[model samples]
Target chain A: MIERPHHVPERLGLLSGAAADPFLTEDLLRGVQGHGGVDLAKVVEPLPEDDARWAVEPLRDLVDDAMFQFKENRTDADGWLAPRLHATLRLTRREAADKRIWNHIALAVAPDYVAWRHLPTASEGKVPRINPVRFMGAPDRQCFSRLWWAAEMFRNGADYTPVVRACSNQDLIHNSLRVSLVDHRPTAQALVRILERGTATTGREINGLITAINTAGATVIYDAFAEDEPRDPWALRQWITDAESAPPVPRHVLPTGPDEEPVREDSVAKLTEYFADLFETAPVRGRTP
Target chain B: MKFYPYKRLNRPIALRVMSATLKLPDGTFDPLDTSAYSVPQRTVALGVAQHEDWISARIGLSATLPPGATDADAPWSGLRVLAVLTDGDTNLRTTVELRQDAPDSKEWSGQIEVLRDDHAGRASLAAYAVATVDGVEGRSITETDADWTVDVVSEEPLGGLRLDVKQAGFSKSAREWLRPYADVPWVIDTSGRLPLVMINTDVEGFSDLLGGNGGGIENKIHELLLSQMATDVWTAVFHSAVGDLEVEPDGSPVFPTDWRGEVLREMLPDVAPGLHVEEALRRVHRRRTDDTGWVELQTRIHYAAVRRAGASKAVANALRALQQMNREDSE
Candidate 1:
């Protein structure tokens, strides 16, 4: 186990691409002796003092547990980490969009977790690496952000159960996140529902479904047939207001989200049934017609 | 008693009072057949008459008039007649006059002054207002007439006219979710009217409306609704009226600061041009639908609460080892 920094800042800060460079040493990439956390701390700009929103400890605890639990199969860390991270972080979408915060988390607070989950193999012909972009990439490409956003889009209403199924397949996040089509709540839920129903099991099958849906989305007005009701803004306001008194998100169980209602069941079912049909005709590579 | 929106009281009514339950006080009930078209009865409906003649016939002959008082004492005249209504506590004195050119046509045109829209604004009034000289029931003032206007003389103290949707028998959330836009004078109707605030908000999360899936539910809605407000204030106020939209002191979205730039771009386009104006409006219409900005900021407080939780386990381990060595030497 690597030692955490003695003086990890109390709140989250912006660790920009330039600021994060020196911290990505070979030892840090390998999850071994690393010493620049104190120096790296200076460059990161602190968030508001009144806000207790940017604490780095729960995240530290979460990653520590994930690392300990998934030591044997490091890639499997994402399944446990994604939901727990989203639950622990409890961030709204705008907060997550700021890449600087993720940079701070990856390089300043828990570079070791980033390195552990994504450290590349040092094969004979290639140099071993953990790309800087993983620490400060787009939401889907960054290590923590990808997991957070995947949990956000995939979760149904307050339920994180769908997110578990979503993160179960690495290809779902890898392939689906890049496309903008997955943003529709019903569409996102339908994709997961199809996966749950065993409609598309393999990576290639899910990929084919995603491709078809994205293509169909441009022409079809999905909302016309499968309607989602208007949500009350007050519920969200109350939820955001309640953040101050919220208890720690339970580790063993998935935490509930803002009480905004789920996508209507019928809408999801309709989209699910529709997507299933789209998937059947979609071209899957290596399949015999 | 929220502002109750409705189908205009006096426009031509196609659907008449239906059912055995709706008989007039005189034991006469006129039910519309499948088409549901009929006028109100004279006893239950308001009649348009010359202001001078109506007051003299009804109020002038009344015992309520003082001794030896001439018709001049009455404030009303041929130019304006008051729709004398009272459900007792609520006194709605609507003074209206017919168009000068069409006085014989019997069509009262001009502003509807709601002196009081209390409980006095009855469901029956909405159905039975604007009847014939024989008190024949008439049409409802549908929004279709671009010229029709309801001028609220003063809604103060009692508050502005609202779509008392619950009172009008619309499905409702436990608590009121929308604020009444009193400035925009709306017609009183017994038919449950949806607030314009809701339809104007593009945040109407239709799946086909397709949001950024990865965005937080709060951010996505705030982004869409705030921009909708900027592009069209009258249209977007529903998002604000709903009580969920948070704006800065300057009235900008608290989250998604750049909301305007993107919102302006999307709304600037004629995004959905194929639909007719009425069709487009119908699509945005909401009836008894609950809205939520309904987002909460769940503070992940365990982070700051466990401030030292990020301190090096190695350093703590080293400190423990030192403590053990000192205790062993003492032993």
Candidate 2:
């Protein structure tokens, strides 16, 4: 695998699609060649120089550690990297929505990580290419973004433990992230609890359950039945503000998220029971009556 | 009315916004502009990006249930009214309980708190009357007929499909991308947070063609040009919306939650009449992916786009103009 960028910037920069496309070469995606930092640096639109949050070296170091530690099991990296990535790179949803920053990170800072993580297994004669979507696509598909958003979605306020459990199951994140139904805090927690209980272990079963939950959500407002508390916005703002002075997220221990209150216990219990009932009748492809 | 399997209040609940205030960064409350809300449209624009620092908003709500709601013979007991604030974008729902004005009175009032950080853009505020019925707790009996929109980031107090329109000289514009399309009269970009219609000022008289309010042929032509632009925009956004749908485990397409959902819900009926929006979406998805009947569906898509653009109305006006012109020429 290729090494990290030779010269990391002081702060992160935005890389537009027009600028990033040239470096996304077929050879680089196929894992044979890589883009050197020198040429790619010219096109990057740098973020504000004074913003401490935009610093790049910490992010580079984190990804490096992730690659080295999970060298044996690539999929295991997701569970480890998600919470840490979210905690280390603190951003508001508005800031995170900007694709340019994610593009810069993928193409300029960590093309090697993207290639190593997403490069497909080799066939007898077919070339194994990393999907471009992993580098620069929708939030649910992109390599780094999917993890960050997974943590944001599954994290019960200040808790990051649930995020780890959600990321452990790739099928859960891959299917659940696309649906709006999971945005409900109780709904998100209930799904995680279902996963932990080993009710819907397979990808097909998880997919079936998620589909049923979303379809049923169209008519039934989950929030009404499973009531979630009003989140304290001050807690979230304080969390984002504290990122400036906060220390590096500990490697061994899971990092904490925003200080807002977790989903109510009764609410999660209500949805858990409702979702379990739905799963019993959900049309899993191979499940027999 | 939407049907409920369980017993519910037959009459709709009367809900209204009493007042609204925004909390500033320095622990002070600023009364939001009275113009922030549109009663007819059921929308509240909590100012623009300037209010981003505003921590939270408090909206005073008043609701009156029907006469028999509080009677002894009422079907359900333990009745409670709640004001709910929900943002689909963030998936956050906050509910506040409302107390009765007097013992056994039908009137209820309360203040609902809206956290700014919990919402990214627009959140909806609605009132629901709930009570235990048939052994089910927190069962909704009635709700506001139309939920009010609370847009934290918009300057205009309006709701639904507010497509942005801007004018810039394509050749000399700050947007480098538009320079390449300098020759085109207008362009529609659906990739951003909201759909935008960029009118090229470099194309001389193009703005005049679109903006002018003249008599006879000039007016007719202006309307036609606008209709054409609207047609293109609706078509582009519709294609963009339907082209990228998330599928269920059983291979059925799921409706999007963003502006794409708005576009689909608005246009799907015209695209496939007499069918539910979900069914229409499925048909559209099947046609596109299976590569069968897609070519045939183009006419329906075009017709839908034209209907939304009001092209038929423009054509009617143009016909009337043509008839008048011929009569004058013959005279």
Candidate 3:
């Protein structure tokens, strides 16, 4: 087990993939060992000092508690960690887009968590290695980016319940997360609604439904059919600001995101009902009529 | 840094599939049970027959002709019976392309198109597309980004006669790749450089498309494409690093002639030395992977109609694609 750094940085910083390489070692790959943040912290180029969002311990403690809570089964920690992480480190898409911050979180803050979540399942392989790509990959594939993006994409405004549901099914996240479609408030919510309804109960079903949704999106103008309210930038700004004095996102229950209006119920219901029908007819390879 | 693994970020659209089946022997079109997408009151089925295609075997969506429907009925009224000509992956295809006209929003609602494939359309099959309606939604026969131009003969009964998109010269990707290369006076360049550029472009695209997905036949084919292009001289030109290439007087690209003469000898030694590249590519037919990456590629190759798609290595892959379709249909 790795200990939390005694010296938590005051602000976040950019940690390039090239810069991240030195910290990843063989023991880290195997989940046998992890390092403290003190040394890794040296490489990061700190963000603006006054930004309250830059605080690191809240983020650090979230992962530490997650590791301890889900010790027997680390992968289960994702559902617990994602929303808290997103709420804990409030930022706009612009801030999140920078790879360095995530690189820092994965390498410096919780390299152990990354390895714990992603370590090889089988002891035997050409080499039991967690891909380096996970350490510094695209926002959707990297260890931390995926969770953050999932929280961003799947969260119903102010409602992390959908995020928890979306995170539960790994395939659900895989098929829908990277697609531009998931970015929509209703599209994201509709998928969760369907999952809750047990329409797409399995990974294969989810994959087929996602593929079908993507295919149909070409012709039909989803926006024209299901209109969304314009986003209030003020709500987002206030949410980020509140992180300064915000209470820790509770673990026992889902947390709320920005206190903005949730997606329209009619629109979600409309897409949900429609998507459910699509899943019925979608081509699942072994499925029968 | 490695790119984040993502599927083609399609604009999410709401689609309602309005589809049915056509029994050829009876010449009757029986509507399959489609999701609840009601047709507009102006028509039972649009007098406009947009697309159509045929396959001997397969179950699922079938096309249908209205009772007593005739060629004389131009824009047939009260005729919901129509045949889906293409983009219907080697099976009975009925593609339902809703209006993806939401320029501002990528998320669409109405009828959701599932299967992500095995459906059909005339000018363009149904897909979640944006930015260029014609470029993306209007192009190609499968769940791909290729465009197809169909002469929807209103008279073609059942709307089923599908024609291949005018051969490769019109392909969008080929246009992008060939536009710059064509302008240069470079000719008689047999250095395998152009092919190398093409191979690299595809490799990069493939990496973006298939990089993160779990292993599948598409990955295998991508690996095969990479290895063959790198090792095989005839094909090596296509896989050469783009930075190192220079144009030839005769328009052939010049690379650092690392041509594996022995590989070419093994495949087609008897062919004239320079002609080997063409033969090697033509030999490469499409083996159907039913992968999004495969569909994207075949559309481009077929569109570019490079040196006659019938002979293009990518087109050769199309042959395998056809075989796969046949297998699916038969199954």
Off by over 4 Å in 2: A1-49, A98-104, A121-132, A197-200, A204-227, A265-289, B1-5, B10-15, B48-52, B64-75, B103-107, B144-146, B169-174, B205-224, B312-331
Clashing pairs in 2: none
Whose TM-score is greatest here? 2
Deviating ranges (above 4 Å) for candidate 3: A1-10, A35-39, A122-124, B1-331
Candidate 2: which docking quality band? Answer: acceptable
Worst 10 residues of 1 chain B by lDDT: B55-64
Candidate 3's fnat? 0.00
Task: Write down the RMSD of all candidates, one decimal each.
Answer: 28.0, 4.1, 20.9
lDDT of 3 by residue, B1-331 (tens): 2131222223222222344233322344434332211323111121123223321111222222222222233322211211122321111123332331243332233331222122222222333232222232222111223222221222222221112211122123322323334332111112221222232233234444334454544644554443343333233222222223232223343222222222333333222234454443333221222233444444433332223222345435645766787788899
Write down the TM-score for model 1. 0.47
Query: What is the TM-score of each predicted model, taking all chains together?
Result: 0.47, 0.84, 0.50
lDDT of 3 at B206: 45
Clashes of 2: 0
Ordered list by TM-score, greatest first = 2, 3, 1
Q: What DockQ do you compute for every candidate structure?
A: 0.01, 0.33, 0.01
lDDT of each residue in A119-153, candidate 1, tens digit only: 75577876666665576665677899989888877
Q: Model 2: per-residue lDDT, tens digit, A102-172?
A: 88888878888888788655668978777888887777888998888898889998899999999888989
lDDT of 3: 0.52
TM-score: model 3 vs. ground truth: 0.50
